[model samples]
Structures are given as C-alpha cells and as structure tokens.
Target chain A: MKVSSVVWLTLVWVLLWGTFTPLTLVGGVVVAVLVLWVARQAPSTDRLPVRPLRLLALVGYLVYDLLVSGAEVSWQVLRHGPRACGAIISVPLLTSSERVVTLMASALSLAPGAMALEIDHDAGVWYVYALGPRGASDVERTWLRTMDVQRRVLATFGTPEELARVRRLIEERVA
Target chain B: MITDVVSAVLMLAGALSCLLGALGLVRLPSLLSRLQAATKPQTLGLFLVLAGTALRVDLKSAATLLLVGLFQVITAPVISQIVGRSVHRSGGVRPEVLVVDELAEERPQDRPS
Candidate 1:
C-alpha cells in the first residue's frame, strides 16, 4: 500500500475521533493498514505516476477554476435556468495511458461548466457534457475549453511522447 | 470575537452556495446538465463549510475538519465522473436538449438507430 494513502486514512481517523493520544494514533495506524489490505484484495490497477510539483500546479489550477466556474454556473443557473444551450462534446484523448485518462476525467469534471459524461480510453476519446447559459456561438468555444483541459492534464502527468502528441493535436485542433 | 464573525459569515456563504446547487439540480432541464450543477458548487460549498467549521473548532478538531475537506475535494470529481458515465450509458439524457452529439457520429456502432 502507498504510505501516503495510509497516512491520510490515519489522519482522517484521528480527526473523526477528535482525539490526539498516542494510543489513538497507534490504533489509527492499525485501522489504516487494515483498510489498505482490504483495498488490495481487489484486482491491482496500474500505478499512476504523480509528480508532486505538477500535482501542486494542477491543484492550484483546479482551485482557481472551481471558483471561476462555480460563480459562473451559479449565475447561469439563477439567470438562464439550467436548460440554456448545453451539449455533450467529444474530446480526443491524446494519451494512451489509463491513468492519464482517469486524471483528465476527474479534472475535467470539476473544472467549471464541463463534466465528462463518458470516457473510452481504448478509442483515445471521451465525451464531455457542458452546461451553462452559453448561446449557440459558444458551443465550439465550450468544446475547445474542454480540449484546453486535456492539454493541461497532459502537461502535468503525461510522458514526453504523450505530451508531444498532445502538442501536435492542440496545434491541429485549437489553432 | 472576530473569528466568530468570520466563521459565521463563511458558514452562511457555504449554506447559500449549497442551496444554489440544490436549486440548480431541480431547475436543470436534463440529467447531464443537472450533474454539472450537483457537483461543482456543491463541492465548493463543502469546502467552505468545512473551513468555517475548522476555524471554529479546537486545534485537533480543526485539523480533522480540514482533512475531511481535502478528501472531499479529491473524491467528489471521481464520484461525479462515475455517475455521469452511468447516466450517459443508460441514455438518461434527454435527446432533445443535446445540440451536438459528436460521440454518436464517431461511434456508429453505439449510436441509437
């Protein structure tokens, strides 16, 4: 089990119990280990490569995006009433990695007006469902915004080859 | 005293956002659009409420609430994605509201005839 996941669980355990004794800390560790062990009983998936600095950058962008998107959607929801010009757009996936696909899926879902409705990692494509008060002109723009997110995800965790392909794809698609 | 005021304001803001998210959920025309509203602002509301709670609590309890907030941020999107995929595959979306369906065109096999 990854030490970080275990430590995180223990921290959560400690906080939930609202106690800070050595015995409780030790007990938290035991419980965390047990939880990890149970999680391991399932089929193992490929390990995702996480570069801390890049992840920190992603987190920073997500925070900013969440605030902007939340406020934007909230405004649209209040003014336009949720039916305003929404579509499910198909986004081309540049990377072949399942982990990378998963990364982009979660990140895109949280980033403002777009939520990933379907992901077909094998076919190198996914569908994003976009919602907002955007008019018809903005449909292309919304799809392009979702592509921009793919670029960021590739930059953060993708291999050099994958990133290069993404760059090429961006030039072809975005430009 | 100042901390108390800050906590109260933050909590109120969180509650307002949460309320807005719920309203969006009810008001959205379709399932896909509703998922967007259910996840984004609701996630923010959660973070704000947790922060407000952490600020008002003792040190250890504060740490606990902050940890909970962090986990919520990490997991909320994944859950949203799961729900979205299930809905999409099940044809839960209203076909009329969709102005574009590029995925359908690309995969004719999956396209509904």
Candidate 2:
C-alpha cells in the first residue's frame, strides 16, 4: 500500500467530515485501508518527473485560457443564441502516457470552448469537441491547438526521454 | 477596506459567471454544448467564489475552502468526461451543429444504436 495514497485519501476523508477529531482520523485510516485493500492493483511506483517551471507555465496558460474561453462562450450564448458551431476534430496524440493523456483531457475539458469527447490512447488520438471551428482550416487550427495542449502537458510531466520523443514526433509530422 | 473591495469584486464576478453558465444551459443547442456550459463557467465561478470566501475567512477555514476548490477542480472534469462520453455514444448531438465529426468517421463500428 502506498503511504502517500493512504495519507491523501485520509486527508480527503478528514476534509469531507470537516473535523479533525481522533475518532475521525482513525475512521479515515480504516476506510482508506479497506478501499486500498479491496482495489489492489499494481501501484504506479514511478515518481512524476515534474518540471516545476513548465508546470507553472502550463497552469498559467490554463487559467488564462479558462477566463478567455468562458467570456467567449458567454458572449456567444447571448449574441448567437443556439446557432453556434460545434466540431469534433481528432488530434493525433504525441505521447501515449496515460497520466499525460488524462491531464491533457482534463485541462482541455476545463476550458470552456473545448471538451474531449473520447480518448483512444491505444490508437493515439483524442476526439475533441470544440466550439466555433467551422471549416477545413478552422478544424485544422483546432487540431493544432489540441496538439499544443498535449505538448504543454508532455513538457510539464513527461520524463526527459518522453520530451525528446514528443519533439521528434512533431519534427516528423512537419517533415 | 481594500480586501473587502477585492473580495466583493471576486464574488460578483463569480456570480456573473454562474449566471452566464445557466444562460448557456438554456441557450446552447446541444447536449455536449450544454455540458460545456454546465461544467466550465460554473467551475470558474465556483473557484472564484471560493477564492473570495477564502480571502474573507480566517486561515484555518480558508484552508478548508481551498480544499473545496481543489476537489471541485479535480472532480469537475471527471464528471464532465463521463457525461460527455455518454452523450457522444448515445448520439445526443445534432449532426447539423457539428461541422466536423472525426470520431464518428474514425470508428464507425463503435456507433451506438
């Protein structure tokens, strides 16, 4: 059992209860243990190779994107009514890492204008639902934007080898 | 005084975001688009409200509010993903609204009845 998982789950339990009583703490530990024991799988032992500066950059971009997209969507709602254009463009995945994919999808979903509808990690593609990408050029732009999101995610959390792999993949695509 | 003013601004902005989210829910044509409104703006609104509340509260309670925001951020996307997937699978979206549907084209066999 990963101590960190136990500790994190227990913290969640305590927070949910909104109490730090001894009984609450004990109950949290017991519940965490039971959950972990029941759902026993190969724990991911790899420590995340987080690049702090890159992670900060990713976060900053997400926040800005969120605000801008939110305003854009809101304006669209008021001005355009129900006639807004929606598109589902599949973007090729750069890295096949599950964690990176999950993070990228979540970040994309959290921003207002785009949401990932389906992720085929095995196929190395994400089917993303985007607002306002209408024509062939717009779809291509949206595809590149999704790839950019994936690139930021890879840079922030990927190992050095994985980062190099992504760079190579991009270069190959360009070539 | 400055803190109060800032907090009020944050809270008001949060409220406006929530209103817009609700408006989108009613105005948007499709389920996926509605889900976009339901999840995204509401999330930002909640976060802003939590931030404003954290600023006004004592340190300990502020920590709790921060946890609330953290949990919301972590879980919101998961919820949206599940719902979005279901909608996509069930063909809840109108074809006219979608300019490009690569998912349907890419995996024709996976289409739901």
Candidate 3:
C-alpha cells in the first residue's frame, strides 16, 4: 500500500472515532498499517494518476448530474404513477481499467435515474438501468450520456496513454 | 440570522427529498425503479441534511458530519448496484415496462427458451 493510502486510511479512522487526540492519531496510524498489511490489494494496484483539475471538473459534473437527476426522478415518481417507462442500455467504454470502470459505475448510480447493473470488463461494456426514458431515441440519448460519463471518468482518473487511446477509439467509432 | 435561515431551508429540502423517496417506494412500478427512488434522492437528502447540520455545529462535529456524507456517497451506489444486479439476475426486472433491455440477452436464464 502507498504511504498516501495509509495516511488517508488513518485520517478516516480518526474521523470515525470522532476524536483527534495524539493517542487516537497514533492508534489510527497503527491500525491503518495493520489493515493494509492484512488486506488483499485491490485488483488494479497501480497508483492512480489523478489530475486535480480534471477530477474537480468530474466531481462538479457528477454533483450537478446528481441534483438534476434526483429532481427529475422525484418529479417522475410524483407525476408518472404506475406507467413509468424505463430502459436498460449498454454503453461501450474505451478503457477497461477495473478501477476507472468501478468509479464510473458508482458515479452513474449516484446520478439517480441511471444505475449501473453490470460491468463486463472484458468487453468494456456497462449495462445500465435507466429510469424514465421513453422511446428508442430516449434510450439512445441515455446510451450517449453514459458514454460521456465514461469519458469524463477516464479523463479524470486514467493515465495520459489511456486518455489518448480513448480519443483514438472515439475517432475510430470503436467506443 | 441569514445562516440560520439557510440551514433551515436546507433541512426542509432534505426532508422533502426523503419524503419523495418514501413515496416512490409505494408508487414506483418495479423493484429496479423503486431501488432508484430509494437510493438516489435519499442520498441527496442525507447530504443536504448533513450540510445543514454542519453549518449549525462546531468544527469537530462538522468534520464528523463530513465523514458521514463521504461514507454515504461511497456506499449508497454500491448497495444499489448489488441489489440491482441481484434483481436482474433473479428475473425481478419486468421486461414489458422496459423500452430497451440490452442486458436481457447477456444472461442465459433471461434468454427466451
């Protein structure tokens, strides 16, 4: 585990304890180290190359999407009654990085109407359950929106080579 | 006074969001849509409530509230995903209501015999 990961875990530990005394801090550090040592490493164990600016942008977009979709879903629930139309669409992603796809899945789910049901990493596809899209056109739009979400996630967390590869795939209509 | 008013508004909105979520539970069409209604607005509601509380509380308590919000944001989606996957696999999702179900053919059981 990286030192940064250890520090972050310790911070979370202290926060969970709701105290910041020296003893708590020391205990948190020790526990964090021990947990990291015992825990199996995450599937994609490479250090995440996070671009702060892009990450901020991605976060801002997610928050905006979340609020807007929340309101939309709320309105749908109140207005649509039992006749609500939904769809399940598959979006092909450019990158197959497990970590980035997982992040994208979480973000998509948090956006309210669009919930990621399954991620086929080998095929680089996400099967998303979307609420309240009506016709074929609406489903197509949802698919495109999901692709955009994947692009933003890739931009934020992916390495430069991954980003370039995605761009190339987009250009080739492969993604 | 302004801060207090802002906090009150935030809390009220949060409560309203939660109410919508509960209402959706009773009114939504299926398990998946209900899951959407259950998790998303409730998540937004919780965060809004936490924001309101953070404004009223001291720094330490506010930090704890921030932690609560972070964990909710992290965990809610995961819970939703697990439930949704299970629902899909178990034939809980009604295909008649869906306009397009790309995942329907992905599972052998879901395919037409």
Candidate 4:
C-alpha cells in the first residue's frame, strides 16, 4: 500500500487500539507517526494540506454543535413525542477525496440526532438523516447550511475549484 | 464535597437523558426520527456519564472515558448519516417535502426494480 494509505490506516489503528491494550497502543502510536512522516515525504495526489487554525476552528464548531444538538434532542424527547420527528435527507458532497468525504460524513454523523447512512463516492453524495423540524424547507435550509460548513472544512485541504463544485452542486440541489 | 454533589447530579441527569433518548428511539415513528432520538441525547448522556465518572475515577480511567466519549462524538453522526441515506435511497418518501429532487430526475433508469 501507499505511504499515505498506510499512514491513515495506522492512525485509525492507533485510535482503535489505544483504548484497550497499552502495549499495542504505544506501538500503534509509533507506527502512526512514522507512517505520517513517510507519507509527508512521498509525492502523491491524496496529499492533505490542512490549515491548522481552520481545522481547530472546525473542531470547536463541531463540539459546540454536538453539545447543543444533544440538548435539543433530549428536550424534544422530554417535551413532545419522538414521533414528531421527520424524514431522512440526502446531502450531496462535493469533494472527491476519500479523506475529506470520510471526515465530513463521520463528523456530521457524530453530531447528536444525525447519522451518515450512505456515501456514493462516484457521485460525491452523502445521505444523512436528521431530526426534522416544523417545515420541510426549514429542514432543508438547516441541512444545507450545515453542509456549507462541511464544504468549508473540505476546502481547507482541497482546491477552490473542488469547493466551488461542491457549493454549486449543493445550490443546484437545494435551490 | 460540592464537586461530588455536582458530579452526582450530572450523572443522574445524563442517565435520565440517555434513558429518555432510548425510549424515544423506540417510540419515534420513522427510521429518521428514531435515529434522531437515538443519537442526539445519547451523545450528551454519554458525555455526562463519562464526565461524572471521570470526576470520581482515577487518571487512567478518566483518560479511557474521555477517549470513549470522543469516539462516540465522532462516530455517531457518521453512522446516522449512513442509515439516513439508506432510508432515503430505499424509497422512503418525505411526507412534507414539496421540492422536486433534481438528482432523482437526472437518473431515470437507475430506479430500483
């Protein structure tokens, strides 16, 4: 496998293993760092040039969103019946990079009351399920806005053209 | 002493929220709604539980709980999205939606048999 793939896999492995076995966790970390270094040195198309500050902001935003949404879902359950919730919405993604697509899907899914169900890599689309609000338009608007954040997050590592394509696709679908 | 009381309160609240969320998951009408009930409260509930536990536990256990919380925070949305998307793809119609799906229009031949 390519260095980048190895690096990504090692990082995933470390995250997965680190929670359990201490010895394997240390080894996983070492391998992850080493593979990352090697991947950085290797020339590749999948290279992720991330903006650190922007990434930090994105992380902060996600955390805040998760907390707020968690509370909202809790309140909804407490107040009204969960039956009041609505349908699943499919979000079309713009970036073709596996890393970016994966990150976006996972991030959105991790948020309270949201799920990343399916991804069509070829079409650059994501099917998301979110708690429906009063109006369908409201749900669509909220989802599109959230997707806009995802687009910006992906743009940090990808080209403007790619981001523009994603934005355009989203606008075309939502509008 | 105050911290202990605060921790206990948070824990109880978290546990209650989690139980409510799970109940909602079963009570919700559609798959999408159920997912909403399952994920959102569970995230906060788990976070609260973990936080309370962390306060009462040692450094290593706290670290483990933190990792678990982070993992749940990260993975929950992805799983929900996957499930939601599948529901949409599986011919689950949105009762209140009015807008015509352009992608559905563009792909006339790929409709499920």
Candidate 5:
C-alpha cells in the first residue's frame, strides 16, 4: 500500500464528506481502505519520485510563469488579434514515467498559450496544440515557452538518474 | 490592517488575471487557442480569488475554500481534455492553420472527411 495513495484517498474521502469530524474521520478510514484495495487490484503503473524541494521550486516557477505569460499573452492577443497562425507541434519527452509525462502535460496545458492534445506514451511524445507558428512569430514563442514548462516539470519530479538522462537528451537535441 | 491590505491585493490580482483570460478568449485566433487562453488565468485567478476569500472568512470556511481549490485543480484539465478532443475531431479548427496534423495520421479514416 502506497502511503501517499492512502493519504490522498483519505483526503478525498474527507472532502466528499465535507467535514473533518471524528465520525467523518472514522468514515474516511473505511473509505480510504476500500479505495486502496481497489487501487491495488488495478494494474499499477509507474509513479515519479517527486522531490520536496524541487516541487517547491516548481510551484515558485509556475507562479512566475503564470504572471509573466499572462501579461505576454494578453499583450499578444490584444495587439495582433486572432489569426490562423497556430501550429500542432510534437515535443519529445525524455521521461518514461507516465506520472511525469502526465504531470508535464497538465502543467504545459496550465500555462498560457499551450494546450496539450495527446500523449503518445509508447513514443514518449506529446502533441501540443499551441498558440503560434514555427518561428515566424507568436506560435514559435509559445512553443518554446510550452517546452520550458515541460523542462521545469521534469526537473521537479525526475529522479537523479532520470534528470541526468534528460540533460543529455536536451544537450544532444541542442547539438 | 496589513493582512486586510494583503487580501485585497490578492483579490485585485485575481480579478486582473481573470480579465486577462477573458481578453485572451476574445482576441486569440482559434477555438483551441481561445480555450488555452481561458485556462491558466482562470484556474490561477479563481484559486487566488478563493485564497482571498479564505483570508476574509473564518477557519472552517477557509478549509472549505482549500478543498475547493484542490477539486478545481484536479478537474479543470479533464474538462479541457474533453473540450480539446471534441473540437479537434469535429473540425472546429481551421485546417490550414494546423502546421502538423498527426491525429489525422493516427486516424487515417478521419483525413478525407
């Protein structure tokens, strides 16, 4: 039984009950155990070992990202107005963990100007339907920023070995 | 006094972000892009607004607000996913604008239509 799953199940159980009373707490334990049992029965996939400090840094980065990108996108939209200049770009991800991929995908989607459309889990690729063209203007910029979001997410949840592999992969791509 | 001022600031910030999102929706090109515009600011904006509300309210309500934020975080992406998939398959996007159409490749049957 994963401790985090137990804790998360209990949290949800409490949230559903809409209380933290002794009665609710007792009920949560029962619900959580049942939920955990079901989860155990389900085919378990991989989970990323998230780093506490790294996760904190990721949150800090997202706050900064949200503020900056909010302003940038607002300016772009207001200035340029709507145009049929968007692109569907496939970004290759290095991390094999589904949790990491999903985390990065959602985080990418959470940022302004990037919407993740699909995840090719076997290929470790994410099809990002983002804001602008390749390098002509706004779409390219959005693509880079979206990729940056993924890089930051990978840093947050990746183990040391995984992180090193990503570093090398990025370097190879850059080279 | 300081706490009140801080809460007010947070609220103002949230309102500004929500405004930005609305503006993006109005100004951005496509349905997908517009949906993209609606997401971050809306989520973060609402989260901030809820945080401000929590600050103003008592402890019990604050807990409720926290739970609300958690649920919002969990569900918002799912909503976006459904919306994106529907729009893509239904040809809500301007086909010319899509630089790459891999989905068309995956579902070859979808191409001619």
Candidate 6:
C-alpha cells in the first residue's frame, strides 16, 4: 500500500478510535504518519473533489431523510404489519471505486427502510432491500437518485469529467 | 435527577427506534427496502443513545460519544452508496421511467470478452 493510503487510513483509525486507549492513540498516530509518508511516494492521483457547500447540503438531506424514513418504517411496522413491505431491488452503479460505492451502500442502508446487502464490483451494482409503501419502480428510482447525489459530491473532489463519464455510463447501462 | 430522567427517556426512545428498525429489517420484503430499514433507525437510535449516554456520563466520554456519532453520520451514507451501486451493477432491473444508463455508456469494455 502507498504511504499516503496508509497514512490516511491510520489517521482515520486514530480519529475514530483514539479514545479507546492511550496505546491505540500512540500506535494510530505513529502508524498513520508513517503510512502517509509512504503514500506520498505512490503515484496515483485520482481524487473525488467535492464542493463544501454541496457536501454540507448532501449531509443535511441525508440526515433529514434518515429521520423521516426511520419514523415512516417504524410506523408501518407498528401499524400495518410486515406483509406490506416491498421487494429487493438491485441498483447498478456508475462509480467503481470501493470508497464511493461503499459510501453509497452505507448511506442507503443507514436510511430507514433500506438495507444494502451485497456489492458486485465486477458488475458495478448494489443490491438493496427496502421496506415501505413504495413499489419496486419507486424504490429503484429513489436509489438511483440518491446515488446520483453521491456521484455529484464525489465529482467535486478532483475529476469532474471522470465523474460525468461515470454518470453517463451508469445511465447507459440502465437504459 | 431531572437530567437523569430526560436521559433515561432519550435512551429508551433510542432503544425503541433501534428495535423498530431491526424489526423492519426482518419484515421488509426486498433487500433495498431492508437497507432502508437498517440505516435510518440505527443512525438515529445510535445518536439518541449516545446523547443520552453523554447526558449521564463524564465530559470526556460524552465527547467520545459525540465523536462516534459524527463518524456514523459520515460513514453510513458512503457504505450505503457502495452497496446500492453494487446491487444495481449486478443486473438489477430498473424502473421504466428511467431514461438513461450512464454507467453502461461510460464503460464500453464492460461487455463480456
């Protein structure tokens, strides 16, 4: 692994788990910095560049959706019964990167009614099971739209053209 | 004591939401729908639980709890995205209303060799 990748991973680990123990903190910091140095020597330059304002908006939207849908699903299960639930829908993806794809999966899964089950990297697809009043078509559309938002956000970090191309590809495949 | 009561209530609510979400996961028909059930309640439930814990605990632990919450808020979506896209790419059918398949166009080589 590149030093940069290692560094970033370490930094993330420390940031997330540093509170667990002093040893973890020390180890995380040391390993992270060292890995970062190695990553710097690596020669891959692809990055997802996202605008800050848009990113914030995306986060806000996700949070709101999470709350609303969480309540909706909970209410449905409580009032109507589980039989009203919808079917599993498979969503094809434009982006192939693990980070972007996983982010998409986690986001959907974290929502109220959906659970992302598997990721087929070769096919660039995500399988999600959503439970709600919506039909299969509606669910698929929602998933696509949500992923579109993520694609746009990813574009902000570095390569707009690449992101656009990815978007285009996903659209074509679905068509 | 009042603060403790509030904390207890929040914790209970959080637990309820979590339970509801888990139930939805079991009851939901589709994987996509289940994903919906799994993500939201877990996030909110966890947030509430953390908040309640913070209310009842020391400052450092509270800070840690908040940090964990923030992490969940950040990473949850990313994970969903990955899973959703993978499902789609795996030949999941799309709605008729959809007009385009961008991913397909982008990768001509994705076709079978």
Clashes of each: 0, 0, 0, 16, 2, 96
> What i-RMS does every model get?
2.0, 1.5, 0.9, 4.4, 2.7, 6.4
Per-residue lDDT value at A138 in model 5: 50
Q: lDDT for every model?
A: 0.78, 0.82, 0.84, 0.67, 0.72, 0.63
Give every collision pair in model 1.
none
- On TM-score, the stronger of 3 and 5 is 3
Off by over 4 Å in 6: A1-25, A30-44, A90-92, A115-127, A133-144, A155-158, A162-175, B1-9, B25-39, B70-113
User: Residues A58-84, candidate 6, lDDT per residue (tens digit)?
Assistant: 677667876787797788667655455
Across all candidates, what is each one's fraction of true contacts kept? 0.74, 0.70, 0.86, 0.51, 0.50, 0.37
- Which candidate comes out best when scored by TM-score? 3
By DockQ rank, best first, the candidates go 3, 2, 1, 5, 4, 6
On a 0 to 1 TM-score scale, where does candidate 3 land against the true structure? 0.92
lDDT of 2 by residue, A1-175 (tens): 9899999889988877777899989999999999999999886655577578988999999998889878877876787759978899877776656777788888887665888889887887778998766688878777777777777788888777766776776667556
The residue-by-residue lDDT of candidate 5 on A53-165, one tens digit each, is 98998988866776765665666566666763567766767777767777787777667556678777787776777654534455446546666777778778876776676
DockQ of 5: 0.53
How far in Å is the alpha carbon of A52 misplaced in model 2? 2.5
Cα lDDT of model 3 by residue, B1-113, tens digit: 98899999999999999999888889889888998899888988888898888889988888889889899889988999999988888778888778988888766586433
Looking at model 3, the pairs that clash are none
- Predicted candidate 1 versus true structure: per-residue lDDT over A65-128, tens digit per residue: 9888888778868987845557777778887777778778888877877887777778777888
DockQ, computed on Cα atoms, for candidate 1: 0.64
Model 2's CAPRI class? medium
Scanning candidate 4 chain A in windows of ten residues, the lowest lDDT window is: A80-89
- Which regions of candidate 2 fall more than 4 Å away from where they truly are? A17-24, A45-47, A165-175, B109-113
> Would you give me the overall lDDT of model 4?
0.67
Model 3: DockQ against the native? 0.85
- Worst window of 10 by summed lDDT in candidate 6 chain B: B93-102
| Candidate 2 vs 3: which has more DockQ | 3
Tell me which residue pairs clash in candidate 2. none
Candidate 6 - CAPRI tier? acceptable
Looking at model 3, residue A157 earns an lDDT score of 86
